[model samples]
Target: MPVRIGGLASGMDIDGIVSDLMKAERTRTDKVTQEKTLLEWTRKAYTDVNKLFAEFILRTRESFGLTDSSSGFLVNQSVRGLKWIRRATVGDVGIADVSARAGAANGANELTVTQLAANWSAASSDGISAAGQSRSNLASQFGLTDEDVVHLTISTGTGTKEQKVQITIENGMASVIKTSYGAGEDGEDSVISLLSGKDISDLSLKELTRQINRADIGVTASYEESIDRFFLQTNQTGAENTVSFSDE
Candidate 1:
């Protein structure tokens, strides 16, 4: 005997199947939303990591004459495993000298840089005498107008027991000479203050970094943070890379 199922009975089963499908679709939608949230959370974490690294580096900064409140800080999120980018340094003049002479005093008196160091004491001396006249004037009789920059050396001799070199030509009288062994990079603030006319307080980290990098400071650059780090990097590798901060 053949038993046929009626349309009403089948209808009920079909409705249940439809409902189940709808529920599956909603479940999938929920899963997608959760995944998106996780992604957002990861992004925020990365940003936080970058900020942390930047702050660490800033704190460790050895104060190489930075004045800007926001300078010397940087982060590059795209760079994996603790990478950093630094701005270039410009206006880094290794040597600068301006005296009363326009060109070398004379052919024979030409002072070489190498020899300048040995004769620095004599060159720094000051006395009022004639420049010399008609070749007959005695060398000592004439004013000691001949100044030679034999050499420029830095030393550490500016403590209580230490000594320095100072000279002045005023009122036709010469004072006792003192040699300066350049005090171990101490008193640097005073040196900076002594420089006038230019705003040493206002410096461009970007330009300075560029100059240093070009000079082969061996630094890699990236933007882990929004702004740039205002300095150049050194080429020190492995454990030698102390200037950059770690992401961990």
Candidate 2:
């Protein structure tokens, strides 16, 4: 048969066929690089979400008058990676878990931050009771408030005789209010009795967080149990990554 070339069976263009194969290989490589880039972006999105969660937890703890101790829930994730090969879907890199106390003081305490008066000042007289008028007026003039008072218990030495007292405030106003019963069997719960007649007002949740942050409580505010994922928009051609949300 006479030599034939072109139209699918051209053994005449073997080199050209090889060149075309190389071009296809390069195209595949480019696609792989694109997929990798997408994966990295998605991973970063997950990390940012977790960081935000941490910040919120810290802020919440500080607002609740937990300055001496760090409070709030801590979360972590496991098993994060690309789920889909074609569209390049990614999953949370780790297992999601919370860090909270195992018992009693378990959950987050919802409270706001307020300024504690340095002394018996006038500004602290906002809600003074009738019997507290004279003292309240004097405290207001000097810039003291009720929140400054921290109740404590004192022992009388020879026996376990304990007495409840408000040390931070003036000596006589509401200090050393004994909690013992006449029977001498046992004293009233000193802490409870000290706080029985006290009235406390806390800032709203939102305002409390603001105050905590303002005080530089060393903790940031963040959202917890949030969903961090992105969606790919489908079009006539195919699907591609779109906007991503790092929270629930």
Candidate 3:
């Protein structure tokens, strides 16, 4: 139902007057809107701080491998020579897991080491592997273009940890930007935020080398202009440190 009120007889601009009156009422809405915006900002700040703290705790845990929990030592099956053949006697001393009580017999044993771990490695296409190569030239060398993607995947610790970084040119800029289109599960801002917004065409080989080194992925990239070659090597030698690449 619509309310009908005519101000014809009084010749009053009722609608205009009401509109003017309503202007003051909008202050409530405006205040609410402002408060809502402030609340959002407060929430964002709290959330960001919380996330940063969470990340700090997680990294600390991973680095030290320590926690507020009970722990025990258990040798894995890989320890071949550690299998106890006989109990240690009271007068024997060797690498043996046994219990010697009052007047109990004791024995001795030997231990041996066998194998070592190795890391995996891979190289990018030699087309873009030249020293002092510009990023703009990379598209043509790798058969990529504007808005295309180049993916680099690094696997560590038998796939327990893996990071994939997706790269693309910024809109209306020749600089680099971190994108989510093909980024690995844990490879967003942390792994590929280096050299952000810097034009690749303008960045020298030495500068690119610096950025790659700063990525903290336990790998180093160096360019040798004298031989027109680029090399990617792992900081640690182990088969678990695998590197792979793709472009689209």
Q: What is the C-alpha lDDT of each candidate?
A: 0.36, 0.36, 0.53
Best by the TM-score measure: 3
lDDT of candidate 1 over 1-248, digit per residue (tens): 99978558666676777889999999999999999999999999999999999877766542432223455654332222211232222232343333322222333223345622111111213322234422222223332333511121122221232332222223332222323234346643222111122221232223222323332323432211122222223333343233322111
Candidate with maximal lDDT: 3
lDDT of 3 at 209: 63
The 10-residue segment with the lowest total lDDT in model 3: 74-83
Clashing pairs in 3: 88-106, 88-107, 89-105, 89-106, 89-107, 90-106, 118-238, 118-239, 119-238, 119-239
Descending-lDDT candidate ranking: 3, 2, 1
- 96-213, model 2: which lDDT tens digit per residue? 3223322324234333436432211112223322332332232432344664544433222113323222222333133223333232547335332222232223212233223223
Model 2 ranges with Cα > 4 A deviation: 1-16, 67-248
Off by more than 4 A, model 3: 1-118, 122-159, 170-192
Score residue 158 of candidate 2 by CA lDDT.
Answer: 13
**For model 1, the run of ten residues with the poorest summed lDDT:** 115-124
Q: Give residue 235's lDDT in candidate 3 (0 to 100).
A: 73
Residue-level lDDT of model 3, residues 40-124, one tens digit each, is 9999999999999998976664344333223454222222232243245433343334443334445454555366555444554
